[model samples]
Target chain A: MSRSTRIMMSVIYWAFVVYVFVPLILMIMMGFKDSKFIGFPIKSWTFDWYLAVFSDTEVLTVFGYSTAIALLSTVVSLFVGTWIAVLLADRKFFGRAVMFGLMVLPALVPGIISAIAFRIYARVLGIEPGMFAIIWSHAVHNVPFVCLVVMARLSTLPKSQREAAQDLGADPLVTFVRITLPYLRPALIGASVFCMLLSFDDFVRSFFLGGYQPTLPVLIFAKLRSGMSPEINAISTVVLILTAFLGIWAERSMRRMKKET
Target chain B: MTSDAPTQGAAAGTAAAAGPRSLWSSLARSQPYQKFVDVLFASQRRSFLILLLPPIIWVLSQHLGPIVQMVSVSFTDAYPRPPGQEAKFTFDNYLLFFREPVYMMPFMRTLIYAVVLTFTTLIIVYPVAYFLARHVKRENRMALLLLLLIPFWVGEIVRTFAIMILLGNTGAVNLILKSLGLIDRPIPFMYTGFSVSVGIIYLTALYMLMPLYSALEKIPASYTEAAADLGAGAWTRFRRVTLPLTYEGIGSGATLVFLISTGYYGTPVLLGGPNTTVFAETIAGFFHVAGDKWPTGAAFACIMFLASLALTGAFLSGMNRLSKGGRK
Candidate 1:
């Protein structure tokens, strides 16, 4: 590469990084700011907001709901997604293409529309909107994502291993458990983690379907819309860190899976 | 889990060999377990259905059924659901949607914003995606890409709030400008059209990057090398080979970004001023203040959904033709 070209590339690279990270850094910084107001200039540093987040019952309750729903949906999505993905990867059947499209449709469409559709369904069915409604709605949106991730990983596995196991007098289920399952372990774990993060971060579906008590994102949206608070920044910083940690963990596992295969 | 299977099998085999009358041998020869295994792998259809039924049923009940219900509600005279009145079928909701400039304007604006945001994000992320896909060292590329994408996983609400703080009256941007004497007063960045647009771009720009990178990365280097050997310059090689090869990806990325951005509710509501109303916010508004106007909201959602589908179909087909031409 020419000197000018190399220089230009480096500039663009750093600029992109800064553009993405600056706001995140700023958000974290503001959480530590003692003042209620948000801005660039830092005054006295304090951990009051973080402390307040721990004691805030409303935030804690909403967070508890978010965790419970995310966990429920992620576990549900993992099994369903793995089963669907295994079928998609291992089998050749009629209407496979159409089934694949239908399976992926929920992810392809916008979440707001899903929220609208589910809300309407709730109304028509006279189902009271709450945790039950929100968990299932989140599942609808997240199962496709889990399926897609696991399918990608499944596609990478060698087909010969299962055949070899079966030729060795192993039953089909034994072949799968002995050969395919280990290969898919990383993908399954990664998919579950991804689904967990997705469910935790989801706001659109939860916003509409959550009845009296809302999830964390919904509560945060309400708080942000009504007004700004240092407390929100503190909570958001914590959420951001948690998500980043899980994301990196998922990324590492996916990388290790790739390397292993 | 499978890693333990071999060792366990070997151990069981040794135990059975060492003691023919052992419990392990008996269990291995158990008739009920044998039958259960045979039944479990009985038929592919049975297994597929058993495995798939849970998710399929959940998706059908939660997603497809509701979508059908929502579409049906859009066409019914369900608005102003009086205390004792039943809804009848009518074309009035669709008519009002098309005829009213009030509803029509936001619909059009939403499309226009989607297009502009799609292109804007494409232009900004394309080079970065290309650099990551092609220029970065192979060993480090995945880590770097993950680093870039981690911010996106931070969630939309948090990202928007970050922008709100960055562009607020007393935000970092204004504070910096004021400190440098660039402006005596803070710019009205928050609650403005510019802020909403920028926020939407910030929230979704990475989505475009991932697809574009995957698409660009899939283009064989050999194709570019062949073009280069044919006396093509760098720019010519890129234009004739790289760009054409990735047109499908570009279209997919643009479509993804457009669809996601256009349906944005929180970003516009939080960052946009009163003047800036998107279709999503409008739909939410109808539901918020007036419980009886659900049909109107449902109609708006149906229109948005159809419009989005139409746009994606057109874009995909157009790109298919373009990519085919490039191939030839």
Candidate 2:
């Protein structure tokens, strides 16, 4: 709290902001660069890279595929993960701790290891790895995030409304449908957006599981491996902007919900 | 049937007495589905079990099942089978991991880098997280945190790619330094442990910051005031009150950073030179580049997984002890 300490703290704070934004700014600038090489001192500006990204059929197809998978996986995770989260929040069963650990275990495990497992599982099941496998992998990986958010929201909910509903002879299902589910709306929205972003941005799992039909990140990684291009920069910038927008929106809504609560 | 009717009538009467137009009462009016709902839910335990069963089964079978499969695969000779030959279970894959210094060195190096990255991120992120928690206005806090997190939402590969652009020989960093007469030569920042660490720290900084910020924010102001009233100096109050309260945050943050850094593949591969091989890249190589070496890959991954599990256990137990000590 000393003057020097205060000055030093503010400097550190701004330094972090600069550290985070500088690279991002460079990336955005690269997207606009006419040259393929990403470097300082822009020689010219062009929208050709952006246009190329849109014109390329493979990139467009992969983008569409990634979007579809992300949406489906998010929806699936929200449905199933909400149930698990609610159960964890509502109950104190004997195996509760174990259940919680198991729920979060997938998220904790390294994605490459999961990818390896998924690859083996696919081979064993005689199921060819494709969009289905990738979607399933993403949904499973994302369940923990949904569960965490929903559980946090559930903990904040007062027990009285739920108890009162049950006290009036409402079944647990009805109480959940009418009372508890509504209470979890903001958390559900926030968590689903988060899960969607995670699934969309996931690379390693998609790389292994996306055998024939690669997701956007898988394609991007593959493209980058070959070498960098302004086109890749364009696609990355688009993805970045989309995710950042969703993230900020989710945070805003969650903050608003917090204030209301 | 007669007893059921009487009970139903009593329930309706009680519901009506409570409030006929209430949300619960409205739901209760759906009498036709009530029996079906009761049969399905029956008990809280039954309902919870029914609800939990699907996701649990999916996670276990689809997610954990693969990991379990990896462990089994590592035990078997998953590659180099002759025509009409059955692969047998053996410890050869794991043995290779320990015997080969190429594998063992990277594993050790990964742990070292993970520790270094965790501590580096902790040191850099702590002050910022503290400032945001203690100084930022309530309305601005969430927005600022969101800004910090926005870069992370861009994906790790993209972020690392950006870092590569920033630190490449002809990158902005070098160009700026050169223009400022800071250096005559472009620093080879792209292919080094320094770059790898910087990239990893940048990618995972928010993970550390958010937890630390929340933990610091949760510290009640009254405790600090009480320390001040006791004639404690700023440094003394911070060391005793602030540090202990936020120690949990540091533990969680460091654990997260370490876990992610150890498992991370892209940063080390893209930015790091030959000397900076990480455990994940090695695993990736085994699976991707080395033909018919998946068993070895599985074994290496299993070793890494076990280490991660141990780290998690230590952190959790330490956390438990910390919470217990705090109570006293």
True contacts kept of each: 0.58, 0.63
Which 10 consecutive residues of model 2 chain B have the lowest summed lDDT? B20-29
**lDDT (Cα, tens digit) per residue for candidate 2, span B1-328:** 2355688797877766777456665556677677778788887677767877876687678657888888888888865355698989899999998888888888888888877778889889999998999878888887778778788788877888888878888788999999999999998887888899889898889889988998999998899999999999999998788887887888888877877778777668778889888888889888776446888888889999898768767876887788668657
Predicted candidate 1 versus true structure: per-residue lDDT over A143-175, tens digit per residue: 788888889888887778877877877776666
Where model 1 places Cα greater than 4 Å from the true spot, the runs are: A167-171, B1-13, B16-59, B79-86
lDDT of 1 at B144: 82
Please give me the DockQ of candidate 2 compared with the native complex: 0.62
lDDT (Cα) of model 2: 0.83
If scored against the real structure, what TM-score would every candidate get?
0.92, 0.90
lDDT of 2 by residue, A1-261 (tens): 678988889898989999998988888888899887867788999999998988999999988999999999999899878978887897777788988888888787866677777777776677677888888888888888999989988998899999998898777777788899999999999998999989998888888777788888777777877988778789889988999999888888887887787
**What TM-score, to 2 decimal places, does chain A of model 2 have?**
0.95
